[model samples]
Target: MTVNRFLIPAFAAALLGAFGLIAAAQAQTGPLRIEITEGVIEPLPFAVPDFVDEGGAGEYARNVARVIASDLSGTGLFREIPREAHISRVTSFDSSIAFEDWKAINAQAVITGAVTVSGDRIVVKFRLFDVFSGQQLGEGLQFAGTTQSWRRMAHKVADAAYSRITGEGGYFDTRVVFVSESGPKNNRLKRLAVMDYDGANVQYLTDSSSIVLAPRFSPTGDRILYTSYESGFPRITLMDVGSLRTQALAEQPGTMTFAPRFSPDGSRVVFSLERGGNSDLYMLDIGSGGLQQLTNAPSIETAPSFSPDGSQIVFESDRSGTQQLYIMPAGGGEGRRISGGQGRYGTPVWSPRGDMIAFTKQHQGRFHIGVMRTDGSEERLLTASFLDEGPTWAPNGRVIMFTRETSGAGGQAALYSVDISGRNLRQIPTEGAASDPAWSPLLP
Candidate 1:
């Protein structure tokens, strides 16, 4: 099966409004030439030599090199040359690189680096070479930071190399903030958990006493917005991720708020408000205590997501007697439905690329994953099954992370990823039954 990439109507309007000439020029320039398909194309081979330094940072340097190599290899797009396969060792940055040795091992790209340490500070210099073409793709770049930041520096280098080859943004240096669940479904213990993109370093930022859901990372990955039931009711909470210090947003008594998402600027959070008996979309100023109601309707209006430019919002509502997607101004205005007359669309999540919105559609007792343009056109279903919803975009927007639940037996729920082309469905490992998975933006 093939997945059809849907372009939100609002994004097309924004392109014509903001970059009319550039958009037109690109249209004339034709579609992107490179299309990744589901075939056994030879993986791009790469070699990452052990970084050496004059200072005795042996273990640290080796770990950094390992992280860089792992990040590149985990994308499923690159194959790493094993350390035992290396024929030559590079010790100095000025040493002549042996490109043939890397090519002989079927490596198309080679990454060489040197590490140095001064007190608590460390410096890392790395170069990326196109071994097949026998040319340097880019000049060597160096990073200087504290010893603890060495891992981050390695990720940065890997990201740069990945971008240079793929011609698209890289997500190696990203973090995923998700609600970690344990215990039974009836009395589950949940906490805010974060992990590296590769699931290597897992850390729980919050305890399991409180029930938290829908943890969204800010654009800078420094803060998170989530709905917590700590105060005996569902309320939006903002926390500085680096500090784990949290403060409740504007809360109303006898009301519940959920499905919160951060604005592109990270200055505000758009969420659904269930006040009295109605659900509507509201924007809360993340910095100030100001509140702006974006949707005023008796019908359910939930899952509001901001456009990348912070100008418009895509959300789901039931104004038409069935759930569907709608787009309105950031400050609230006349809304337009955009779900292509689907059965019932909910959990509409705007893609990071700002071109599409992934949503959950219920049709004939079955669930489907679909995308559509912002203005309610070109709705295309990606995946359909017994239960598949809560679609979250991979940082590059080429893939979607969602939860897949099985029926009967234990009714297991697990996280899975499907490429936008509806191929390469891979299951992401979790400690236990997991659902409502959210992907974070790439780390800066």
Candidate 2:
């Protein structure tokens, strides 16, 4: 997961629907929009009242509304008007709108919903409205799932409202895989764990008896690729996310594999293979067990990432006398250098949009997370600290999450995310220190 940030201005804070949003009538001012640049003076104000409990929903209605508000608020692009300040309540799911009431409190947008819980299933529906324009932002939609997936239902509602407001794809329905750490900093125990995008509902995938690093999700997110040391040497291991079944991926005797990432089609994996103290990039066709070396340089070449279309690969190499970024055809070929910066760059990750690459840069004794255009122009540093590295992109490619470690003997590492525009820098809450976060594609 890789290359890092540059400050592109006038970033649109899009409101993408959760599952989907059908374009509807527009307001006199058109759809609500905001530029999410640095130095936020004000956030878009929105209101979400407690959902109406159609039947047997009880506390679920309130909890769902809270989660929706939390998700939107966390973005730093929207602010939630407290429920206590609301002038009216949503007593009925299909009730008439109170635009004047919401506007009186300076709310530009409002979200209303209803929840119905049947025996083993739950149905949640929601709508977004532009208060001043008195227009529904999009067609109302509902999501159905088992009762156990209640939180995901809430996230869907939030995603819908967010997408409607922002006009971009929503990321609320996504999950993140990360390395959970415990014990002293000098004697840390690490395990692979998966959790909801908001850091909720965490589940351990592998025990901490053996070390794991750089866990990456498959294109469909049904599997994971990570470097494991269970065999007393680093090897790329593939695991079925659902059943926890595992297998070694293309591990040859006397060769170590690490930093593996799935190709766009999920049929191949691109990773770094080290042999005889030299590291290079290689591609493995998972279905055929065929291996192809992509880079044959004596210099270390690692952190290979496929472009969204899988036509090319962006990676980091020290072949330029210093660590830097390069791009090459998916097949074996010579790589063209894209990074010409003063500092060393590594961990180049192509954007989901296929227009940018995110990475970590070390400059003047300071570590920074940054992003650059695919051709290596418009470089922008999003974050700077004692140690910030290994950036992973959000499902929508609008945000990047990575490891931020504190300095000193008792230093700690935690997961942090920042918008590509460099605003909304936030620390993801975890039970313990966490790192190497890989964001999954939005769940189906």
Query: Listing every candidate in turn, what is its Cα RMSD in Å to the true structure after a full C-alpha superposition?
Result: 6.9, 5.6
Q: Give the number of colliding residue pairs in candidate 1.
A: 8
Q: Tell how far residue 419 is off in model 2, in angstroms.
A: 0.2
In model 2, the Cα lDDT at residue 346 comes to: 93
Write model 1 residue lDDT over 291-351, tens digit each, in one string: 9999888999999988888999988888989998888989998788887674899998888
The most accurate candidate by TM-score is 2
Give the TM-scores of the predictions, in the order they appear.
0.84, 0.93
* True-vs-predicted CA distance for residue 43, candidate 2, Å: 1.1
lDDT (C-alpha, whole model) for all candidates: 0.76, 0.87
Error of 1 at 420 (Å): 3.0
Native-structure RMSD, model 2:
5.6
**Worst window of 10 by summed lDDT in candidate 2:** 1-10
Cα deviation at 199, candidate 2, in Å, is 0.5
Q: Candidate 2, residues 326-429: lDDT per residue as tens digits? A: 99999969999999889999999998978789999999999999998888988889999999999999888788999999999889999999988777899999
